[model samples]
Target: MEIMHAVDFRTQLTSIMETLAKTAVVEIGKLFEENSSFLKLEITRCTRENESLQQKCRLLESELQAARKTAGKINRTEASLSHGSTGCICVDICTPTRLDTGNCKLYITNTLHACFPDTAHRPAIDNVFGKDWCLNLWRHEESNAAPNEDTNLSSSGVTVEPVNLLEEEPDMIMIKEEAFEKCSSDKTEEDQNKRLRGAIQKQVKEILPELDLKKLQNVVNHLVYVVGVEKIDDLTFVEVTDLKDFLEPIQCRKLVKTLKQKDFFQESNEQDETPTEITLTPLSSIESIPEQPFFPYCPANSEWLQRFQIPWDRMPPALTQATATGQRARPGARREFVRIVVAAMQAICPNPNLAACREVARWIVSTYPLTFGDITEEGEQLGNGYSCLQRQLKTRVEHVNRDIMEHRIRRPRKGLATKRGADEESYVGKKFRNCKADSYGCVNWQPSSIPEGETPNSLEMKRKVAAEIFQSAGPRAVELTNVDDLMQQTYVYQRHMINSCPPPSISEIELSWPFLFTERGLCRHFKTLTGIDIKSRFGETLNAKAKRILNYFNSQRLRWNEEIQSLLSEIDSDSDGTDNNKTAISAILLMMKYFKEKETSIFISADATSTKMSIEKEMTLPATPRLIMLGNSLLTSSKWFISIEGRVSHSIDSQLDFAAALAVFFGCFYVFNIEYEESAIATLELIQRFFVRINTEGTKCTSKSGTSRKTGSAVQRKSQNFHPRVATFMQRLSEFEWKTSN
Candidate 1:
């Protein structure tokens, strides 16, 4: 039983081993088959890749060969055109093998149409040979045949005239010579020339009526383009007279007789009263006559006078003075003198009227022989003497009045209380009042009262009243008064008071009263009230100090008003109709607070980042979308990871710390917005200006440097780099990149 059990176990173990072996074989075979499949796939991919690479290489080689052939053809075409060889017009030329094809034929047709407009043989040639062969044949035909009458003319069915074709040719030397001789001697030529000359003369005559003599003379004197002076003499008498008429009157008269004497006209000698023929004479004859004198006649005065010879008394004073002084008369003075003289003469004429005083003065200066020496001394003496005479006349009038008053004293009226003249109601009721006062004590006196009568006592009283009035009125009353009032009152104290007030603020003060608060008052107040002499400290004058203060106040007021108005306008314009005044004010306050805090933070951060080149470099990144992502990441990471700490030992120290932080924040904000925007624009402008300057300077330097060794290498390098192909390739690449990006 034990042996049978052991045998069964062995058999089962063998079966198990066999099953394991089979499974291993199946797995190995499957693995092998998968590897084979993968190998085959890879081999096929490699083969296809190699074939594609070979095809690309072949294409590149073919392209290179084509390029070489094109280059050769271009060179050959250029050479042919330059040498003026009649091969193929460059427009028709193509690859040598393609020369026999329809494309080439089409090219030739187009080229022929471009080059020769009247080549009639083009169609026939096109019909006989292909367009390409036609081009070749056309080249041969152009080389062999010169354009002539016999050549194929038009293609549009219109026959070109042989004479017209002949006339188009430039070789007309023989014909020109023959025509010149014929024009010189033939009667027909002479007639034609005469007709032409007559036409020119007639035209000149028509236009000459519109021209001034000077302009006509200029036109006549101008050398003729066709005929020389010798030919001008050959013109007939009538033509010569026409030419003369075109000349200046004087020149015409001079030439007329000479032309007549040249046998160009028949002179008649009959003393008939009525002349049948008009004879034109030489200009010299008329020019030889002496000029006639011009005379001006005055009917009222019954006087006939030569030109520029007016009556001596009709001259102006200044002109007379200038003449006497042997000095050239000024034009203005002469004109004035003439006017004055004419007026004086008219006044003295039969229609006599008193001459104006100014006119009389003008006449005197004009007529008088006042030399420079007399003008220097006698003129001033005369003026002074006249003034004295006037004063004497005035004094005489006053003396006459006194004498009449004294000699014919008012008769004592019946029942008069006192001397009638002294207590007269006529004098008492008179409006004329003297404000003067003497030393005598007046009982009926007041500071505001005006004195009457022209006595020493009255004068003294007036002065005393003025003094009292000023004393009674305090500085404030005087200060508020106008300058005109002070002047009229003759109050010196009042003027002083006004002057002592501070100068008015420019914006706050009325336009009418600018000097209410004068500079002097400000200075005085500074010393009296503040005990600080601003003038001394600032080294400023009273006026300057006042101006400075006014300016400051005006500027402050202007700013305040503008700010207020802007706020008001903003509130009023609000569509919501909310009380935006408070909101605007709050917004402004918030902005200020934010700016202050930001400034402090920015200042601190800037100081911290001073040595941090990485931060600066990062900040310098272009503001593109790509950089925006990175910037956002940096910002978030910085906010999340970075912390700032502040410590202060005292209140003042804390305040300083806060101030510094505020300054830093403001700086950062400013740099991020305003400064960065300005910096970018400035940098771009600087670069552009730099490039412009460089280009301009380089061009100038090259021009000035001339063709020298210093510039040769650089120029050659530039030329090579600027090759058309290279430029085109770069341009295409740029376009491709741009398109791809877009």
Candidate 2:
């Protein structure tokens, strides 16, 4: 029994072993297959990477060859120039006669100018190159007959007609000579200051020979404005830190050393002129210095007072009645009175300083002691009694000044120069003198009146019909000229509806006017309201500035956020090619950070895995318009969406790129006639000024017909005017461009 049991156990063990062997073999086969698949994938990935590297190498090789050819050409041109060939280098290389384009023209022009900087040699150049040679070179045209047909070359090989490039002006040489003659003829304090500034500039240039003349001028201007230092005697007040923004550490050190030497020379000269002995007068015999008024007081019978009286008489009966109530007026009534007073004040002084505003406020208080006075109920003085009025008057004047500085409207002095004797006129200055400002500032934003031909009921009927058409036939159907006409005719009513208090939700607005949400519809509506071709303006500006925009991008060396850094990397990778979309987006981002604004205000990126959550979170915030990037990353974004009024109303294809997306996104603000996101106002304003070139006084504007409505108080306007940052950005860019050109 034991033997038989043992034999059975052996058989059972053999069977079990066979089963285990079969399982092991199957597992080994599966492992081999998995390893083979992984190896295949790895090999495929390596091959792709190798191909990509090879392509990059090929591109680099081609670029190197082109660079070599350019270097060779430049060398030949330089050789010819050094040898005094006297050939029309500009005509040969820059004229339309040549198939090549780019810095060749700039190079020859610069070389010629460098060789002949004096006016004496300018005639020689003219003799050699012809009377219209400079003009031809600048215009890049074969003939000077078509002087108006000037062109600027861009990196993408596209040509753009610059606005002021072709405008006929006095010859620069003549202008300089006239200026020099004027300075020489006048020995006034102003002329002396000019000479002093010129001397300082010359010294600075000597100290920093590598720096551009423009950059040195900027540095001098910085000193003049910031430190109130223009005279050689003022050199003691300047510190190296004052120039930190404009120069490198080493440059700043060198500049400081030079300034110290200048100061030493100035001291030595003063010492040589100082008298050895001094005399003192008795205190009782000395006459007291007159105490100057803290605020200059204009006489009641002065020109400004007379000017104010005329506008004061033109006040509407209702406003006059309201102010005569003698009690503190309501906000609206007070605003009207303040407007009249401020308008009258500005009429006399188009750009009033704080002291001027104080005088106007004092006059107003003296005239209307009961209604506009800043007094306590107990009749105690309220610190000058005109403080409140002064604040208002100062604020109003500041708003207008801010607008001018921001380039929203042309300078009153600039526009006023055109009108004779009216230089003293009391009219609202040209509010939209700049083409871009005019286009953007004319939007029927905050329209208070309906169209002349349309009544409220008619507008409502048109809206209903348009909504029905949009719902049934869709956005394409509404794009028809007929539908567009209806939309245009009711734009005023639409503005009223969108701006209604306790505003409608995004879904409600979309449902009621779906066409307004379409891309074409948005642009058409914006154009109808603002008279601005948003797409064309944005595109033309972007394309014209494509090379500069890329230069601006590559110049950013500041430590940035991860996202911005990633964008900068992409831009660097695509350095050989120009990508307007990428450059524009990066520029906007960099500018936002430069201005110390939150990036999420104008742009939001969502991970593809959690787009819903990311966007949902965004919606919960305020209804600020935003550009949404919906994908795992910005570069690989699957879609772009414009999120306005807490909803993604428009989706743009990824391939359309961010420029188009931004254009549409920007249009949405005007089409809806909505305010920019509060936090992102600075960033949006930067884009408006830098990209769209629309520097309107205010976004919440009035109708186009009447005198342009004034912007808000100084505080409000200051918040809205991001021109300080924009100006700094532009100044830096200008300096960079000057460097590149030189």
Score each candidate by Cα lDDT: 0.32, 0.58
CA deviation > 4 Å runs, candidate 2: 1-440, 446-455, 556-567, 574-577, 607-622, 653-655, 698-722
Q: Residues 1-742, candidate 1, lDDT per residue (tens digit)?
A: 9999999999999999999999999989966654453355357546645644565566667768977986786565445334433433334222222234465546656765664444532222223343354456446544544454243333334332221211232133113455467546555543544444333333343433323333333333222321222233333243334543234332343243334343322221132222223222222211111212322222332332112233565566776666644543443564454454444344343222112222223223333323211121101112111121122222333343454555334345565666676768568766753322210111111122222334445444544453454456532333444432432343222222223335222222212222222232323332322223433433322223223222332333444444444544554454544322223222322222212222121111222222234433444422210111111212111111011112110111122222222122212111111111221222212111111110100110011111222333222212110112212322233334434445
Error of 2 at 636 (Å): 3.7
Question: Which ten residues in a row are the worst by lDDT in model 1?
Answer: 693-702
Q: Report the lDDT tens digits of candidate 2 across residue range 1-742.
A: 9999999999999999999999899989966654453355357546645644565566667768977986786565445444554443233232343333345445545765765565433322222222354545545554542543344232335443322211233243223355567556544544445555566666676666534444466677556544557456566557778886665444565566556654545544564443212122222222222222222245433445443452567665665775565444444556667777677766676765555665666656555555565433233223344655566676766776774754334345544565755654545464443222222334345554578878888999999999888878975785488897888888887777676666667787788788877777787777766556777777777655655755665666564466566656775665434555655665666666556666776777876654544676655544767888766555455467787767677866445666678888987766665656555665676566566655443343322322111332223333221234444455456546756766
Candidate 1 overall lDDT versus native = 0.32
Each candidate structure's TM-score, on Cα atoms with residue i matched to residue i, is: 0.12, 0.38
Can you give the lDDT of residue 131 in candidate 2?
35
Deviation of model 1 at 498, angstroms = 72
Q: How high a TM-score does candidate 2 get?
A: 0.38
lDDT, candidate 2, at 533: 78
